[model samples]
Target: MPLRPSRDVFITCAVTGAGDTTGRSDKVPVTPEEIAAAAIEAAKAGAAIAHIHVRDPETGKPSRDLGLYREVVRLVAASGVDVVLNLTAGAGGDLVLGSPEAPLPPDPAGTDMAGAEERLAHVAELRPEICTLDCGTMNFGEGDYVMTNTPAMLKAMAARIRELGVRPEIEIFDTGHLVLAKWLKDQGLIEDPVMVQLCMGIPWGAPDDVATLSALVQNLPDDWIFSAFSIGRNQLPYAALALAAGGNIRVGLEDNIWLAKGVLATNGDLVRRAVQIAEGVGSRVLSPAEVRAKLKLERRW
Candidate 1:
C-alpha cells in the first residue's frame, strides 16, 4: 500500500477496555449504564462505532456477564443512537500463571478460560452488529497473565461468529496474528469485507512505530477494511497516522485516558478530538450508517 490516505474515514470509540484502568481514571465507566452512556456520548460526538467491554458494577473489574451486556445494549438502543455496536468476544481466555517456577495450576483469581460458545454467550443472545475475534494468543502484559487464543479456539469462535450472522473484527496484536486472520479467511471462517483492528503499543504486542504500522498496513489484504490504534500517549497521534495510511481510527478511554498532558478525558471528549484531527487533515468523518454500508453490516435492532 503506497500511502493511500483515506479521504473518508470512520472512527471507532472503544468506550471502556478490559484493562485495570479504573483506578487511574475517574472517567472510566464501570457499570453497564455508565458504559452505555459513554458509548452514546461518543456516538453523539461523531464516532461511527462504539467498541464496548463491560465491567462489574461493584468491583469495577472486567466482566462477561450476559445481563450486564444486555442492559448496556438495551440502553444504547433505547437512546436511539446511530452508532454501530461492537461487543467484545475477547474475554474468557485469561490465564495467570501461579509463579515463574511453579506454573502447573494457573492462578484461579485471574484465569477465566472457557470454550468458544461460552465466550460468546452474550453475542448469541444480544446479536450485536459486530463482535471481536482475537486472532492469536499472546503474553498480554506484565506478569504471568497471558491472553490465550489458540488456533483451534480461534477457529471455533470464528465459525460460531460467522454462523450468528455477525461481523468479526479480527484483532491483530502482532504480525503473526495477521497470518492467522488470513488462515481463517482461507478456511472460509471469515467472510467478505473482512474487518480488522490493528492493535498497537501494548507491552507484548506489536510496537507503535511508523515502520511497524506501515508494515502491518502493507500486509493487509487489498479489499479488507481496517482501523488502527495505539494505546496510552501515542493513541491520539496514531489516529492521524491511521487516516494517512488508508485506514480508519479508534479512540476513547479504552486506549488512552488523557486528552492532553495531565488532562483526563471522557469518551465524548476523545471522540470530539478524533473528529477534529480527521477534519483538520481534510478527511471527512464517516457516520454510523456509512460504516454499516461500507462493511455491509446487518443492523440487528
Candidate 2:
C-alpha cells in the first residue's frame, strides 16, 4: 500500500484504563459516575469515541463487575453524549506469577485469568460499538505479570465479537502482534476494514520512535483503519505522528496523565490537545456518525 496520510480523522479517548493510575492522578476517573463524566467531557471537547474500562468505586481498583459496566453504560447514554462507545475486554488476561524459581501457581492477588466467555462478559451485555482485543500475549512490564491472550482464546473472542456485530479493535503492541493480527484475519475471524490500534512506547513491546511507528503503519494491510498512540510523554506527540502516518488518534488518561511539563490532565484535556493537533494540521476531525460509517461500526446508540 502506498503511504497516504489521513486528512480525515477520528479521535478515541480512553477515559480511564485498568492501569494503576488512580492514586497518581486525581483526574483519573475511579467510579462509574466519574468515568462516564470523563467520557462525556471528552465528547464535549472533541472525541468521537470513548474507550471505556470500569473500576471499583470504593477501592478504585480495576474491576470486571457487570453491574459497574452497566452503570457506566447507563450514565454515558443518559448524559446524551453522542460519542461512539468502545469497551475493553483485556481485563481478565492478567497473569502475575508467584516467583521465578517456582512459577507453577500464579499469584492469586494479581492474577485474574478467566475463560473467553467470562472475559468478554461486559462486551456481550453492553454491546458497545467497539471493544478491544489484545492481539498477542507479552510481558506487560518489568515483572512476572504477563498479559496472556492465547491463540485459542483470541479466536474464540474474535468469533464471538463478529457474531455480536461489534467491531474488535485489534491492539498491536509489538511487531509480532501485527503478524498475529494477519493470521487472525486469514483465519476468517475478523471482517474487512479491520480496525487496528498500534499501541507504541510500551515496555517490552514496540517503541514510540517514528521509524517503528512508520514501519508498523506501512505493514498494515490496505483498507485496515488504524489508530496509533504511545504512552507517557509521547502520548500527546503521537497524535500528530498518527495523523501524519495515515491513521487516526487515541489519547486520554489511560495512556498519559500529564497535560504539560508538570500539570496533570483530565481525559477532556488530552482530547482537546488531540483536537488541536488534528485541526492545526488541516485534518478534518470526524464525528461519531462519520466514524461509524468509516469503520462500519454497529451503532449501539
Candidate 3:
C-alpha cells in the first residue's frame, strides 16, 4: 500500500482484554455492567468503537460464557450510546502445554479450547456491528501456550460473521498473519474493504518497532482500512504512528493499564488522550457515524 497522509482518524477502545490483568489494575472493568459503562464512557469521550472481551466477573479471568456476552451487549444497547460495538471472537483458543518433559493432557486449568461455533456463539446471537477474527495461530504470550486459530476455524467463523451482517476486523499479529488475512479475503471469506488491526508488541507476535510496522503497512492491501496498536507504553505513541502511516488507532486498558508511570488510566481517559494526539497531529478524530460510513458497517441496534 502506498503511504498517504491522513487527516481523519477513528479510535477503537479495547475495553477489557482477555488477559490476567484484572488484579493489576483497579480501573479494568470486570462485570457486564462495568464493561458496558466503560465502553459507553469511552464513546462519549470520543472513541468511535469499543472493542470488548467478556470475562468471568467473579473469577476475573477470561471466559467464553454466552450469558456474559449477552448481558454486556444488552447493557451497552440500553445506554443508547452510538458507540460501534466490536466484540471479540478470539477467545477459547488457548492451549497450554503440559510440560516439555511430559507434554500431555494439555493442562486443563490453563487450556480453554472450544469449537469454532462455540467460540462465536455470543457473536452469532448478539450480532454486533463488528467482530474480530484472529487470522492465524501463534505462540501467544510466554511459555507453551499457543493461540490456536486454524484455517478451517477462521474460514467458518468469517463466513458466519458475514451471514450475521457483522464486519470482521481481521487482527494481524505479524506479517504472516497479514498474508493469511489477504488469502482469506481472496477466497471471498471476507468482504471488500477489509478492516484490519495490526496487533503490535505482543509477546510472541510482532514487535513494537518502526521497521516492523512499516513492513506490515506496506504489505497491506491499499484499499483496505487498517488500524495499528501496541501494548503497554507503546500504546500511546501508536496513536500518532498509526495516523502517520495512513491508518486508524486503537487504545484502552486491554493494551495498557497506565496513563503514565505509577498512574492508572481509564478507558475514557485513554480515548480522550488518543483524540488529543490525533488532533494535535492535524488529524480530525472521526465520530461513530463517520466511522460507520467509512467502514460500510451495518449497525443492527
Candidate 4:
C-alpha cells in the first residue's frame, strides 16, 4: 500500500506502561492520583486519548488491582478532562519460565498468568471507552519470559468487550499478529470500524524500521481504524511516520521517558511534542470528541 498522509490526526498518550521503568525514572506515575493527574495533563496538552496502566502505590510494580484501576478512572473522569480513557487489558499475561537448566516449573515470582476474564476484570467494571487486546503470544524481553495471549483467551476477551460495548484496540506486535487480528474480524469477534495499534520496536516484537512498518500497514484491512507507535528513541519519530502513513499517533512516558539525552519527560510534555510534529506537517491535531465521533466510541462513565 502506498503511504497515505492524513490531514487530521488524533494522538494517544500512554500514561504509564507496566514495564520495570519506575526505578529508572522518577517521573513515572506510581499512585492512582499521580496517574490520573498525568493523564489529565496529557489531555490538556492535546492528547485525544490517555492509555493507562496502574502500578502498585508503594513498590511501583505493575498491578492489575481493580480498586487501583477504579480509583484512577474515577479521578480522571471527575477531573472533567475531554480525553478518551484507554485502560490496559494487556496485563496479567506475563510468563517467566524457569532457567534453562531447570525449565520444568515456571518461576512463581516472575509469572503473572491469569484467565482472560480475570485480565479484563477492570475493563468490565470500569467500562472504559477503549481497552487493549494483545493479539498473540511471543517471547517477550530477554530470557524465557513470554507474553501469553492464546487464541481462546483472545476470543473470549473480545466477545466480552463487545458485549460491554467497549472498543478493543487490537495490538499487533508483528505481521503474524496482524494476520490473526484479521482472522478474528472474520470470526465476527470484533465490531465494525475495528481499532488496531501497530506496536513497533519492542524487544522481541517487530523492529522499528520503515520496511517493517510498511509491510504491517499493507496487511491492514481497509475498514479498520489504526494507530502506530514505537518505544524509546523511536517514539517521537514514529509520531510523524504514523500520520504520514494514514494512521493516528501514540506517545508518552509509557513508550519513551526521554525528551532528550539525560532528560526525562512528563506525559504532558510528550503529548505537546507530538502536537508540534502533527501540526508542523500540516495535519490538525484532533480532540477527544472528534476521535470518539470518528471511531464511533461510546463514552460510558
- Which one wins on lDDT? 1
- Segments in model 3 whose C-alpha atoms lie over 4 Å from true places: 1-3
* C-alpha TM-score for every candidate: 0.99, 0.98, 0.98, 0.98
| Candidate 1 local distance difference test against the native | 0.94
Q: List the residue pairs that clash in candidate 1.
A: none
**Which is the winner by lDDT between candidate 1 and candidate 3?**
1
lDDT of 1 by residue, 1-301 (tens): 3677889999999999998899999899999899999999999999999999999999999999999999999999999888899999999999999999999699999999999999999999999999999999989777999999999999999999999999999999999999999999999999999999999998799999989998999999899999999999999999999998999999999889999999999999999999999999999999888999999997876
Q: What TM-score, to 2 decimals, does candidate 3 have?
A: 0.98
Number of backbone collisions per candidate, in order? Answer: 0, 0, 0, 0
Report the C-alpha lDDT of model 4 over 1-301, residue by residue, as the tens digit: 4768989899999999988889889999999999999999999999999999999999999999999999999998898887899999999889899999998699998799999889999998899999999999988888899999988888888899999889999999988899889888999999988999999999889998999999988888788889999999989999999998899999988889999889899998999999999999999998899999998997765
Q: Which candidate comes out best when scored by TM-score?
A: 1
* Per-residue error (Å), model 1, residue 69: 0.2
Position 141, candidate 4: lDDT: 82
The residue-by-residue lDDT of candidate 3 on 1-301, one tens digit each, is: 3456579889999999988888899899999999999999999999999999988889989888889988998998888999999999999888899989987979888898888788889988888989999999999766889999888888888888888888999999978999889888988989977999999999899998999999999888779999999999989998888988999999999999999999999999999999999889789999999999999987777
Off by over 4 Å in 4: none
lDDT of 4: 0.91
